[model samples]
Target chain A: MTSPAGRRKHGRPTISDVAALAGVSAGAVSKVFNGTGRISPPTAERVREAARKLNWTPNPAAIALRTSRAQAIGLVLTSSSPVPEVGAANVGLISGIESLLSPREYGLLLNVFLTGHHDESAFYRSLAERQRMDGVILTNSVVGDTRFDLMRDLGVPAVLVGTPWKPGVVDYIDADPPSAGIPETVDHLVGLGHRDVAFVSGPAGFVLPNIRREAFTARLAHHGLTPHSVSSVGYSPAAAAEETSRLLDVAAPPTAILYGTDTMAIAGMRTIQSRGLRVPEDVSVVGFEGLEVGEWVDPQLTTVQRFAFQRGRAAAAKLLGLLGETIEEDVPLEKPVLIVRQSTAPPRSR
Target chain B: MTSPAGRRKHGRPTISDVAALAGVSAGAVSKVFNGTGRISPPTAERVREAARKLNWTPNPAAIALRTSRAQAIGLVLTSSSPVPEVGAANVGLISGIESLLSPREYGLLLNVFLTGHHDESAFYRSLAERQRMDGVILTNSVVGDTRFDLMRDLGVPAVLVGTPWKPGVVDYIDADPPSAGIPETVDHLVGLGHRDVAFVSGPAGFVLPNIRREAFTARLAHHGLTPHSVSSVGYSPAAAAEETSRLLDVAAPPTAILYGTDTMAIAGMRTIQSRGLRVPEDVSVVGFEGLEVGEWVDPQLTTVQRFAFQRGRAAAAKLLGLLGETIEEDVPLEKPVLIVRQSTAPPRSR
Candidate 1:
């Protein structure tokens, strides 16, 4: 086989070269090629043989010009924070997308689109003009997201990875109900003999926080139980720790606390210990969103974890489906699983 | 300003339109475009106006066929495991590079290059031929790195983000000496009246592990103090925690232990408490990397931190320097700083 290094200063083998070797006109070769029409099978085979002898391959750029398909997809983290916890879903979403795209020779272009005044519409338009990405997965979608309408009007293919702000406009895949793990989390805590369980929720602007907060409250009420406190705070680790301490100071302190996220629960664990308290013995702690750190830390946390990898895979498959790829068999998305470890136990006997 | 919604269905203005507007032949218009050959001042102004009126921009694919600049940079995380700790530096590096590139309209393409079987050389060659990235940043550069020669011969600009396996082959930047944070950690421990200090290092395959290990041992020796133990192990949290427990079991237990990463230190802290020991009173723990969680935990960890954001910015600036961008004033990299918090104290009085 002719090697790229051995090739002369002459650029890629031209259609004329293939035509001359095959004893055919350039017009005949063009017909046999992917241009407009097809030539006789015998002439096409001869042209293919001549092309193979010269180690020539059709240029994908020229093909892209005719087809208008970039064969690439984009992923964006819709937050400005440099902190990793903010876009934790991106951790698995990336690998899942890579697993499928790399095999099919698709380029995955990723970037962060900071919320507010970033001109996301212009960015998508630029991508289309430059042939950067054919479709995108928008992470951290908020309620009443104008991006849905913007993408729709622009005629760009999109698959949102969060609960959709507007229904029927874009394809979306989130752990269904946005609170699939919360009811089970409450059940596990109540089963562990905890009555006064407080729910510390994340920021209110996003959907998951509200979903987890309401689910926790409603689930407890369903069991004829009352929460000691419900604190809503920003996505700061210190703020969560402070709120956990405040709950501890209340007259009716919760025997167990279920935090809206693993980030908050991990930080709260430290606050409980610093205040001369034990993990399961003094107050049980449960975290939503299973993080690997939860397993590594002391008294491994029992938390609710959405299968971020499977979610990413499902989202990517849906995008391929939009691109006219036939889905042979549907891969079922695994339900949210609760991981119980050393972080929870029966409430201490008075 | 015409809105995108109201724009005509006519495709991106063709070269024929621009040529007609300038009253010049298509061949002449191609010559005047991209400034390969200069045109007369009056003619150039007329062409520019015509192009502006037609809403025509230089097609990147056609330009790429002439000059081989893709105006894009590539980054790779060379690990197979989907662990957050593995790609920690990417969080800041993405933003730092984006801050500089977005205004210039450059694309940043990132993907993982798995180690062992994946051919890094073939990857670079394909990128050049496909116009994916004109340059790349190799994040997990290893000892005897061959990628330097591959990129150099392939004539692709590359910046290695770690200590060069062999110097002078590639432009590289790491926290100067890669041991910038080790000495201060020992100094703080000694100042707190801890005589017997132990060192727990990371996996030996990577440069940072060996760098931290040697620095920890050398610094302790410089104080005329012999270390209680110097253990080198894999990058597992459980292994590091187990090492800490073994160190505690010794007849002469270390008063303070310096861990290789914030990850290992967090796990070790739990082991101390699980064994019914106080943080500073029984055995003080200091982490190498100053992570945010370290600050949120019970006794905030006393550790040394490399400003990852500034390092990322510096690495990017160096890469741009390689790309022939004139950097007016030098941006000196910040040195590693030691942060003393509640994790360390004087040894308990016997």
Candidate 2:
């Protein structure tokens, strides 16, 4: 619609209309909405009433431009897998982060990249230079990750969601020790008389999987034993299945196998069953990351429960703190715990 | 870093620096990156080389402001469940959409909200008025949805990802007939000698589940039979389990049950087994939205394969088309198909 003067008609009212109705300058109306600038309490109330009547809300873009804050956070997921494998932990993390960010009216700028297919370095630089996000939450830290330095150089505040490869490299929130439940898993298997245990780790370069592998190795050494085998593969069902088949083909196959994630464990179980072996009775299986899908499988997955959702929330809160927002400091997340389920048991006496 | 002129020195060069190096105006450099304005091929190459030497990339925000295009798409997920149940389908959809958007240098602005906990209507309005997205992709269309009208009034282009409650109200990409594959499911069950079939549907207000329930009803009516029972519940494992337990308690319990999602079917199977009943043999089960998780569960679930990832990509392509981006027109998605697995069989004779 257009007015007689050829001005385009906005069916809904705008700030200028609100200001006119409230008998204040447009800037004064903006001050009320932005919660900045000096304005009398009564004048603010009048401006609010006018806004309510006109149904006018400040445009976020304009606010962003005025305040030099995008009012958004960035989350970039870089996976080498063909299919984007956003695990249940990642889902939980996203939900938890949204829980906090939603109330604050902050949007999440999510970018998914299949490692080699995209220029991740350029993406980060663009985000920082464009001022698209006030801060970013980084996940899946790798050994010698260059993102931390990149963010620092670009002057973008960031918080890492997993263990940093090097301590003090960045502000991070991690499951303390980064291998919290691995020792418990080892003790559980050893207590059940499992001497030959194997581990199927996530891709080799990831810090989390590396920590987990080392923990499994060190814990087994404590039992006066060593890993029967270790396979490093991408996080995918095919990878898990192939690794499981290879392990089963060994002369003295492992009595128990630990997987980097619950999804991997489920796939491994299917492989074992397809080979005509029973889980736990023939070969015990364990997983990391307590995903709900673990429970629906025939033999519920025995897993190391990391509070991914809470960690996501904590990471967001930490980022908000860095942005100078006052937040209630929550108790730091507890270490991951082992949840023993039907997938694991004493190995059969051969 | 600071220069002698009291100007902040960016360690990395800026567009102006690149322009200076190339002996061109900053606007010329912006034009080269944005691919606009007339410039000789050789000059463009020289500017690119200067940018390479300076390691400069155009800031997205500046480009956005100059062009009035945000270069992002908005996806709002509204759910009533306590936990954000971003099912495998949603995950697939996200991955599919990202597969296209990432290469175009576009970002996805994702927002998750628990229905009543957040004002969804206001959020949509904000997204439209703030120019935060070039367009939006809407999912989970409810009966008598107001979003369609709102988007229309706001003049924001949108593509609905699922069946529209009222056809022709919005541009949509959906399984043709919306009830595709239901007839096959009914035939598969009926041919397996299951006369008393019950259906468990997702939350009642959504268009997809309502269409599915109607399809089941119409198919059974053709067989001169009625549903043993029908239960409408939220799409959650707890809801599915509780409904399954209730269904089993009926005097004339269903010989076969159909579920709205793979996750729900998995939960239902667990419930049946918890009652000491074997799947297929005791009660046949079928699920929809053929998620990969179904394959890992014992007695792998039979399901209606909806091709969620393809649908997601289609939705994105359609949105891109609406945004005036030249995208390859993909063949329309085929009707959903039935995948027979171990979960379904002839019900045991009473």
Candidate 3:
């Protein structure tokens, strides 16, 4: 049979041809580029050389059709409110995923699903008709989500950034916002001789809210100390300042406070200084997100370094795995490290 | 003459029917909905009402083919070295544009043309041939860009977020970076008793660099006080801090600093404080970009409030204006206001 205009008379280069040229198996050739399957380093190199020499370009669409995938991945986030923290996080995640997908010839379709932002039916239609993307990476997953259900019913593969209560055999990469990072933070503070600590948390009812609070309480108990109080505030520096001022007014307030985000921590520290209180002496502050602002916030805040970019990379990897690429289980959860700066110290001996 | 669907075929709403129902011309209906013509409010409402009643759906493909315009818009941005500031700015711009396009049933295609980030040719080919977006939005335009040249050669319409010096008649919507915002900031600082002010700018050789520096010099002249110095640094908090530190160590330091962005202002403040100096009392600082963080930074930044949302809206309007709709030149140059907060004051009575 004659080949297409761009192909040789024997038809376009098949996996086998590429494999033979590379001195590797068809599977090894695929895995070499995909970062999966078993292949020696030399064999992998050979496969890449062969493919390049043969001018073989993989058809993503045909592969999608054959593999029953869309060959494109969806990144679902809300751009409606567009808070700075979430907005910055989204940027980091997108860039991270792009780092992986750019080389693989995979396309990312950003599907922002915000109620009241657009005609919901149009977005639904795009997903229902399989017109937009193949697999999806769901960020900020709310419990018992209809979007997740719809994605599942459509048999479209998806990976969640946050844990879903009933993800139902769906793949996911979750951050241990409560126990993993918080306990380590508490231990670090204790090591710094902090006996009285306060907890500042995000708004209540979300998964992170509950998880972080419990972790705070449990970690406090382990350290033979009860938190001065748990303060919950809206996500903003102004809100954090208002809440922190209340805690600072108490008769026996904590010497250190752990903040949910760098924004809040920055505000809290400023508020303490406004009251003429010193950080790490009269009061110490710890923050999450390791925002660059944390360093500029007077006594550079001591924070746990959570890899937002790596998390994004992991999310992309999980979605890719769901698309028939085998990924190893027991994948190492990115451990957050405490970057001790000027913000932490021993409580005053008095 | 019979229509393409045949004479006296079943009643299906056409552009002509929308025109008739709306009590306006067919061209007006096309302009209002297809983003081509400018129609009055009431007349546009009538056309929309008719289209809804008749359940008219314009064939996007046919429209694209006939007009040689893709019924979509391409947003071109860099993906390799993703600048969070630019990324955030683009997000605002994209979301605002989405608001404008969704009502008109136009699809948005986001393309990140990071050199070596992806298979760029395939993406360009698909965007040109398959995706077929009508026009493109090029953000952060560099001088003498090849992207603009290619779009022009392809006969596609384009609207730039920043000014373009490429050969053809290119249209753009840029914040009055030099004259409007940064100059006003200097004027405000000089008015507030800061005689020796410094300018901290983003990378040299960029479009805004020379414009902003000249504006600072001109504004200083207007105030009868020459600036101590102007320094160019990379677009990051760390870089801003390092540059600010150098400026502060000079023999005769500036009493105040004008930063290119809110993040830079925050960093500059920290650099001053690290030397046991206080903001306003020792060295006041001002910044650009009315980002949410501007309000939270300690001694909350006095800066120019460039309405990013409005900028996005204006860019979209300009794109619509280019699509055969007449829009006045004054509509695009919406001036930004100076948001004077607590960051500026009379130089310390030292």
User: lDDT by residue for model 1 over B46-152, one digit each (tens)?
Assistant: 76566656666567456546654545677666654433233443555666665555534455676665555344554555455455666877775655668889788
What DockQ does predicted model 3 obtain?
Answer: 0.10
Rank by lDDT (best first): 2, 1, 3
> Model 2, range B1-78, lDDT digits (tens) per residue?
122112215366777777777888988888766644576767877787777666566755456557766677887777
Per-model B-chain TM-score: 0.79, 0.88, 0.73
Score each candidate by Cα lDDT. Answer: 0.71, 0.82, 0.68
User: Whose lDDT is higher: candidate 1's or candidate 3's?
Assistant: 1
Residue range A212-305, candidate 3, lDDT tens digits: 7888889889988887788777656778899899998888888889987787888898889889899878998998877655665557789877
Model 3 clashes, total count: 3
Q: What is the interface RMSD of candidate 2, in Å?
A: 3.1
Model 2 TM-score is 0.90
Collision pairs in model 1: none
Best-to-worst DockQ order: 2, 1, 3
Number of the predicted model whose DockQ against the real structure is largest: 2
The worst-scoring run of ten residues by lDDT in candidate 2 chain B lies at B1-10
- State the DockQ of every prediction: 0.15, 0.47, 0.10
